[model samples]
Target chain A: MRVLAFLDGTLADPDAAHIRVDDLGLLRGDGVFETILVADKNPRELRPHLDRLARSAAMLELPAPDLEGFERAARKVIDSWIGGRELALKLVYTRGIDGDPAGVPTAFAMGLEIDEKVQRARTEGVAAVLLERGFGPDVAERAPWLLLGAKTVSYAVNMAALREAGRRGAQDVIFTAADGSVLEGPTSTVVVAKGRTLYTPPSTIGILPGTTQYALFRGAEKAGWTIKVEPIPAAELTTADAVILASSVRLVTRVHTLDGVALPDSAALHRELVAAYESEY
Target chain B: MRVLAFLDGTLADPDAAHIRVDDLGLLRGDGVFETILVADKNPRELRPHLDRLARSAAMLELPAPDLEGFERAARKVIDSWIGGRELALKLVYTRGIDGDPAGVPTAFAMGLEIDEKVQRARTEGVAAVLLERGFGPDVAERAPWLLLGAKTVSYAVNMAALREAGRRGAQDVIFTAADGSVLEGPTSTVVVAKGRTLYTPPSTIGILPGTTQYALFRGAEKAGWTIKVEPIPAAELTTADAVILASSVRLVTRVHTLDGVALPDSAALHRELVAAYESEY
Candidate 1:
């Protein structure tokens, strides 16, 4: 893999690039990140991703990220790539080394060839399990410090939930809130379709608003599909005509089965959504 | 200040110690860690911390950590230090660099001088704010994947909570469950005293079991103090004789006021608890 890392405005070999062990981002997961998809050396939806990154950094009280610096670095990495393969560009900003007087933020931009697993999940749908997120839907509103919408790097619980799904022979998981309301996937957003209406759990419920989902919703709205953001009960998922997990890297991935039960046929819907997503970029 | 970092099995300068930018520990916060306090070159409650680390690693489904390697590295770091100042020894194990064929784990032990702020918080009681933890007490039992009992490196929320407390002119925070039940502190276990009984919220409520609090409870039990684990209501705290946040590093920190409401006097109890904690080591 021809990987590249832009460390603090300087591009370095990704294999050798490292952050201090005491970086709060590594030690305490006190950081924020965004993964952007680059096709044929062109990054998609860079501005929105950068904006979200800034929002996440603000929520953590870390210094504001250098957006222009990140943009330049991303372009440099993408331009340096030799292959035509899709690249996964990751931008990270972490609270710097502990106890430092400067308290500088460690920023890095990394590029790598898209993973085969993610490609596979996109092409051949996914078997998903419903997992409890352990937080009530209203918690985010009541406790902003919980950082429900910030997309912070503290994803240990999210990773563990995904692993738990894998152990049960599932490829993905949809986290339901403590009140049994459908939340989102570990690394993606959940969207369900019923006839011409599309439903996604509201971001007000403390879920990270999905960039790809927003793009898809915009395109879908132009295509005469009604978009509704509201609480989705777990039981309503089985009745939907189609269900999909949306994210920047994965784009639109169909959920073939949820919790051992096969979902209704939605191959045509998946195709439309994929087309809408690709058209946005 | 002199610092030491054990990279895998090799001890190196903490200033230069770094992990790959692609490490999942940093990217996804997919790792487990333990922070042990070293007083006068001795790591207090080392065994319990190690046991908890293993349990945390298991929760993350990371590979089994090399406990003996960690122990040797810790001893080496402590031995290398010449100063009598207290040290904070942090051990971390993360699923290795992304796309590695071997899937090796990145393990490191880092040593640093304890912060003066932590020392002051222990000697003088801290003003604390009560924050909502966003989960009902029973969520941990219902959703094990939340990894509530495991002290994973994903502490962004905890760090945010502390920052929020600081913004409110407080030094610490006590997390309350969604149902208005007292949980634990952002970095410490909540221990309340009324007469001869010591009350701490049970570990079953999804809080990390406090090793220092456990040690204190054992000594207190032997000294004729009754120990009880139950869900403590937030209102009950104001009436308590004394309340303290107990952790490995902080030891015992009294909560002088919670949410601007002054707690009852407990200086005599604080003295006794401090003596009990020191004697345990």
Candidate 2:
């Protein structure tokens, strides 16, 4: 399989590749991680994404990855591209090899071929559901053993929610804490257009801070729109004029339904965010 | 750099090992693990330890390890022993490699050597202190995002706590929640003897269920000692005759202090549990 490898800002092959049974990330969902999308040979929103990765690593006390090195390697991978096809590049750093000093972490990066369908889905809109079987917000907040905000490698439950949504015939899932507060989609940031204002959850409330969503908001302001960061109740989600899931590759895709309820037209908001993200480049 | 290697229950030379970093365990902390003492070339309390491993895997919906094969491989490693001395063995299994499947997991296994110094420290007793850092317990019961009860590989935090304890000049650290409920140590189980009954925190409280402690409790009961599984407060620990940290290799070691406060002798309980572990097989 094709993969991008790097360390300290140089592109290379992974020195060692294969998961040991002892790795904490996969075994206990015991880690956090961040994924940045590389568009048409350029990593979108590099600074904000790396900044979030550092913040998450610090929260978990995991040693910070070599961000500068990572950026160089990522660029190398993008530069190696001979075509202008939009690519999905992911940088994953796990608490490294077992039996080593716990401080230094194992890191790797690779490019994936994301389906072109996601870009089309953004305008056409995708179906979604509110995941009901989710952990409580306080548990997500206070459990030291819980890797809440940090995107450590432990992501079983998160992936499970996606599968459950798929089995029910939805393209993605939005989660609400036990207390009924709307969180985010499995791998995307949640955004809703209320009038002309763009709203997203604050990361401090245990959501992965989305670099793409932040950029969209910045572009939104320039496009003459207001932005709001607030705790949204799950009940309020279905009433949004347009609901969207934002990630690097997907940009912003509108949610056409919540559970089984058909959402009202959100094509205009979707178009606005797409144009905003693209124009910023 | 001595290490042990086990695969599908067969002992292999460490250099002959093979694993893929993409294995679910390494990628997602998507597996369970156990550490057991190799006493007189036998895995102490084998049945219960294997049972616990199966239970933990079940909790994560991963396939159980091949216990019968595991037994053969473990014995093979024991037979290859160049020295006839006792040692500690760690067994780790992960879901094997995959192309980032959403939910399905793969599995693999490996063995490693535990420090001989840990065994030596048991005879002299170790100084331990309680960290004011709270490890909230209620969340384990309520939070679906938590794998608190399982001894999964996502143990970076546990190791971090131990490193932090060492930095503070303490041999070990115990965690207490904000409300003052005592939790387990970073690598071992915490047990305090009060009057006649022996007490240890329940695994349902988000700490690992200790194999050594479980075996020792059975040994204690067989020897007519009263045992209890409940929450112990920090205040109660300071008042105890002895506080012991139990694990496979250490067996049962006495705690001499709690956050710098000296404690009375714990030789009796330590001796009792050590004999109990030794008498097995």
Candidate 3:
């Protein structure tokens, strides 16, 4: 079952839920979105997602989104769901009608069942290819206009990266900067683990700070795991104890290989990391 | 008056026409779009726009869009416009509903009045700033998956760049490559005129091929003007006889200043370039 609600907590007919044709979200992709995972029909870490949504809006210079309204809409939909143990809740906010000086923003929340591919990746793991993302470490500070930290709706490049992965007979991509620094995945954050320590790239590298990754790192830290926020070179990933990509919906998935070469995988480490992330809820 | 039409040439109420909520167009910005200028109620260079649309879809590895259907839809909308001297006709194609393997693409056409800002930019000219766009000249070939040459709906960066221009007290932007090569404008193509010669950066530099700029050069070349398709250093734009930005709807607009330094205001040259562009019709 699927449920759709506008920011005001008003439910619309799923088939008839429509936005304006001139909505800048579709026309120019001038918007931000968050994909939240609902466990047992309850949205996990909704507050953090809302906070990140506000952060993304600030980065885009779009008017501040109505966070309370979004939270209400999200709760309204998830509470109304009569099926599924898990749901992928998406919150979307777009610069409204093109020339409306009122600066009203179009926002909505929808609850959808988690796609089977996400489940497969979580259980079966993923093979990824390292690809150049065409940015340097200085981009975040020097070019704030690029909206690197903000999860804007302009994800055509990210989608293309996934398709490239598919073409290479892999299921995922790990982006590398021009200086060979390991970046995040197309739709996930990179995590490298060695023994009891977990390592991740800092948000200063012009990448979106993954909410799930932060939770995982925090939980692991409390469990006596060293969390190092440092620059990771591309060459270092293949030699790590375990390489994982984390996202809100996908949780955590270990990479089985990089560019056709096998990398270390630890199912035990995966379970432990997943538990750490789950403890946040 | 604004008019909206589907791929089958069926007109719909502007307020009532709605797409599926799961359309990848809105969710991930997984789509391609074109904005064509309707001159005297006729879409200018309709064929080239359709060709470019197809090329963009191919670049994104999306299913080939129905060109004939798009043409019919565009004509249907433009033909129904009964207000204003000119309208901007937009054709949009997206990778339909998310999980459906059938892969039916979402496509539509719309007719809108030219924005007042575009008109002001054309007649009064614009102040432009040079911004680093974070891509090199070899990006198109090296990373085709980046969608650099495609006019995809993922234009958040372009929108942000325009906002950056506003913040910098400029009206437009000329994106420079990481290697200091002059690229195209965010929404327009850069054209430099020196006496009887016109120079435009080649499409090889990871920029969209501007239909209006091509027509301008072709028309000017037939009229005994030198047309050079070569790499333009970012510094050369400031020294040219005149700097202009050209796009389908905006047509041609001279750059009045570079970083607040007043540029040559050549009314005669602007008129000549406009005439050369109009000659294409």
Query: Which sequence of candidate numbers ranks them by DockQ, best first?
Result: 1, 3, 2
Proportion of native contacts in model 3?
0.70
How well does candidate 2 match the true structure in TM-score terms? 0.82
What tens digits encode model 3's per-residue C-alpha lDDT throughout B151-190?
9999999999999999999999999988898899999999
Q: Alpha-carbon error at B29 in model 1, in Å?
A: 1.0
| Top-scoring candidate (DockQ) | 1
Q: If you assessed candidate 3 against the hidden native complex, which CAPRI class would it receive? A: medium
**What is the CAPRI rating of model 1's predicted complex?**
high
TM-score of each: 0.97, 0.82, 0.98
As a whole number from 0 to 100, the lDDT of residue B203 in candidate 3 is 92
Per-residue CA lDDT of model 1 for B1-281, tens digit only, reads 55565644566767774688888888888888998999988998999999999988887788888898889888888877776568888888988787788999888887777778988888788999999998889989888999998888899999999999999999999999888999999889999999999999999999999988998898888778999999999889999999989998998889998898778777788989988877776
Q: Predictions ranked by TM-score, top down?
A: 3, 1, 2
Q: DockQ: which is higher, 2 or 3? A: 3
A131-242: candidate 1 lDDT, tens digit per residue: 9888889889888899999988898888888889999999999999888999999899999999998899999899988988898899888888899999999999999988
Which of the predicted structures, 1 or 2, would earn the higher lDDT when compared with the native? Answer: 1
Residue B25 CA displacement from its true place in model 3, Å: 0.5
CA error at residue A254 for candidate 3, angstroms: 0.4
State the displacement of the C-alpha of residue A262, model 1, in Å, after optimal TM-score superposition. 0.6
Candidate 3 chain A minimal-lDDT segment of 10 residues: A13-22
